[model samples]
Target: MMKEKGLLIVLSGPSGVGKGTVRKELFSQPDITFEYSISMTTRVPREGEVDGVDYFFKSREEFEKLIEQDRLLEYAEFVGNYYGTPVDYVRDTINDGRDVFLEIEVQGARQIRDKFPEGLFIFLAPPSLSELENRLIHRGTESSHVIANRVETAKKELEMMNLYDYVVENDQVKKASERIKAIVVAEHLRRERVEARYKKMLEVK
Candidate 1:
């Protein structure tokens, strides 16, 4: 029998919804093999952030060139910076039969809906909007103004949650990750994902 092709998992959420935390937890699982799609950005690197690993830092001109060449899978401008997923890496990884995970914002996710409808889209949400604000405040990384802005942006992003195939509430880190893990497992067993592989095997006989 032909082996199943890897899934393209797109994870998205509001700014303070802890999607990254859950992604990190998911990666810790030994059996799940996935390659992360690193995004390219026109923003400057922060302290201790490595090039190509944390983000592919690019000049505005370089980023624009990629856009012109249609090299990006999905892209959006946030807070005056350009951010996009590189198409080549993600395509190659999935073609190689390894799952690829993309952690992106709602705008980028919306774009993906058009380009990659077959991919599994999961939305990570906070238990409540108020709780999302609290988490942002506790982080102490942004000014009150920025926090308020993020909260407002999150409220808008939450409205788009219905667009996703599944919604995982990030009330607790571990629980959320487990829910996502379950989703991945279920996706693998989906009839559509398996039907083609099995069909090919039958035809060969």
Candidate 2:
């Protein structure tokens, strides 16, 4: 049987919507096979963040050079730092028949949509704004002021959820992960992806 092309799955959502948690759980499933796309950034590495594993950190000059050379699939500036996906890495992995998952924010997801319209875009959503605020506060990683800022940003970003192909509410981590996994399975079984494979067999017959 001919192999189908790999899927490019983009996960996007507002800040503190449990996207990272969902992604973590999704990959833990034994049947799910995918590669995580490591993003390149011009920001300083946080404590304990490894160079290539956590992120591929680059200097501003190097990042700008990449932009000029069209090496990035999509890029954006946040908090005065540049973050982008390296085009070659993603392309290579997908071409090798491995699904690639990009956990990104809304703007970066939109850019990916433009570049790869056929990609599967899933939006993660909090159950409610109040719940989202509570989770952010409970984490205690940020001050109240930062939590407030994140809440506001989340509200604005949530408005764009309609743009995604699927919206999964993160009421529970495992449930959300299951829903997303189902979507991935469904996408792989799409007619367009399977039609060519069937045609090749029929031609042999």
Top lDDT model: 2
lDDT of 1 at 95: 79
Q: 1-205, model 1: which lDDT tens digit per residue?
A: 3656678899998888898788878888787667788889999999988898879999999999999999999999999999999999888887777889999998899999899998899998778765666777587766778778778867676677878999988899899888877898898888877898889899888
Return the number of clashes found in candidate 2: 0
Cα displacement (Å) at residue 48, model 1: 1.9
Best by TM-score: 1
Global lDDT of each model? 0.86, 0.87
Per-candidate clashes, comma-separated: 0, 0
Among residues 3 or more apart in sequence or in different chains, the pairs in candidate 1 whose N, CA or C atoms overlap within 3 Å are none
